[model samples]
Target: MFKWKRKKKWYRDFVNPVHEFRYAMEFVEETLEEEKTKEDQILILDFILSVIREDLKYDTLTNIFYREKWFDEGLRISLPFPYHYYDEKGNMLSIYEDKAEVKKVDLAKECVLVFPWHRGRMRDNIKNIGRNEFQYDKFNHKAYYFSPVNICFVYNGMHSITAGIGFKKGYIEAAEYDVTKLFEHVYTDGLYWYNRHNNQKLEDDLLDFRIGVIYEISKIKHHIEKDAT
Candidate 1:
């Protein structure tokens, strides 16, 4: 006679938020793999897009950032079509069914435009926050400096950074840290926040591309079926 043992939840909840996303994506991927025809793929994509649209109704900027849990690449599924994102230097970063690499982007080089989803409110705030007292000194702000990535993670004064960039103020004040002890966690968390914003934009673009793909595939599928008939 043996007693049943319950499985431990990693997040200490019924579902691990991180793996839940990975599992959902894995299911989508497996389903797509089993489809034998373009019509089948189109139908699957359309249904998935519909559900995603409904889910997005409640999704916000904060929620979107959490989607990049642990910065795992397995969370991304291939797009039906190629999608392009441009860097500050106008270099094209293309993503498609095969490419899933996340590039290390330079923030000062217009990476802000790469993810324009969070610009709505920040744009308005940028205007009202005057530049009269703006200073280039690092003593003015509370921000974490990631020496490995050479990027600053702002704990407060995000709008100040936005304003600095918006007006070309050149730089913001940040205290330099040894960060040797906490480098691993800081780097991972910083990268997670950085990639999540980019991934959110990528995710949105993929959904739109999926719709277009469904439309094109639907017509082609119809033509094929009609010709066979």
Candidate 2:
């Protein structure tokens, strides 16, 4: 009887996994269908805008990066740094130097200091951001910094870059706040036009740490202005 009961429980556990797998598959399929519809609408809008005669104006605000060509190469450009560096004595280092070094040494009963090697790259760990598709040209010295708040929109045939700001958390809030504002400024003065375009809603789209740092800087700037007043 014990063996029979054990077999029954094992069969029940095996079936449960299959059931869960089916449910997840169905959810993913539904999401894919929704995304396809949204993409279709955006393509349609692009076609319409291409032939339109009226001047197409979009909101320039809320874009974290400036829309400019940094080099002759086909690349979107933005300034990512307002960085700060300090030494062991808390002295700020100048950017003019080729290399900065820190040093320390130990003798029999005393301590000595010597310069340790240090080199800084213009772009460090830029892959942490969402720019996985673009290749960085280090020799050009154009891709200097990476900004969490700045996103560059580049078209296939376009040489100029359109700068925009986006949260790491997909497009839910961006659709509501940033995209909506852009559409209103461009398409019509009326509201809710961009909100209607959104179909798939992300469940857990939240601000990333890098974006949080940008917000903190804004807050600091606000306080400084307030204090000045």
Query: In order, what is each prediction's RMSD in angstroms?
Result: 17.5, 24.6
Error in Å for residue 11 of model 2: 57
Expressed as tens digits, the lDDT of each residue in 1-229 for candidate 2 is: 9999999999777764335334433443454356455444334433332322111112222121334323334333221221222333544432213232221111111111111111111122223223533322223211111112122222221111111112121110110011211211111111111111333222222112222223223333333345556
**Cα miss at 220, model 1 (Å)?**
46
Off by over 4 Å in 1: 1-125, 128-134, 137-140, 179-229
Which pairs clash in model 1?
138-173, 138-174
What is the TM-score of each predicted model, taking all chains together?
0.27, 0.17
Candidate 2 TM-score over all chains jointly: 0.17
Residue 16 displacement in candidate 2 (angstroms): 51
C-alpha-based local distance difference test score of model 1: 0.37
Tell me the whole-model lDDT of each prediction, alpha carbons only. Answer: 0.37, 0.25
Candidate 2: list runs displaced more than 4 Å. Answer: 1-79, 94-141, 145-159, 163-229
lDDT of 1 by residue, 1-229 (tens): 1232333443356654335444545555675579877577657755654554333322321332454432322223222222344444544444232323223322243212111123444455466544354454445444443222133334444445555544544455443333222211111111121122233232222323222322233333344456557
